[model samples]
Target: MDKLTIIKIIHTVIWVFFNVVLFYLLYSVLINKIDKWVWICIGLILMEGLVLLLFKRMCPITVIARKYSDSTKDNFDIFLPNWLAKHNKLIYTTFFVPILILLIYRLISG
Candidate 1:
């Protein structure tokens, strides 16, 4: 397979991994299950946020994928629907921020 395709697959996998982490975190919060796993998920998400900030809000894999393709689509480096790829960050952040706030509430109220 081509390098761009490989990057796209890898990026898609990473995206899915984060989705699982975020959802699990939400579940943990909902159930008041504050544990190491919750902290781990928060750490992983923060690390990803730091990496994106360092890269000027772009995934490093996306930057590498640019070396192999000239596509102007938002999903040029990921295997996702075009609209999803274009708004993925916005969509996830919308859910994520609320999950985080809820988590904080659970922690403080308990």
Candidate 2:
């Protein structure tokens, strides 16, 4: 397989992994199951956030993918649809921020 295809597969896998983590976090908040895993999920997401900040808000994988493909479309580097690729951060952050806030409330109110 070509480098660009490989990178797209890897990036999509990473995206799905984070989606699972985020969903797990949401489930924890909904069910009031605050545990070590919840903290771990938050840590993982925060680390991803830090990486984005360091990379000027682009996924490092996407930056690497640029070397292999010249496509300017948002989903050029990954398997997501164009609109989702364009607004992925906004969509995920909408779910994450509130889940985070509720988790914090659960932690503090205990």
Indicate the worst ten consecutive residues by lDDT in candidate 2: 100-109
Best by lDDT: 2
Q: State each candidate's clash count.
A: 0, 0
| lDDT of candidate 1 at residue 57, scale 0 to 100 | 88
Against the reference, the lDDT scores of all candidates come to: 0.93, 0.95
Candidate 2 backbone collisions, by pair: none
Give one digit per residue, the lDDT tens place, for model 1 in 10-85.
9999999999999999999999999999999999999998998999988899899999988899988998999999
Candidate 2: how many backbone clashes?
A: 0
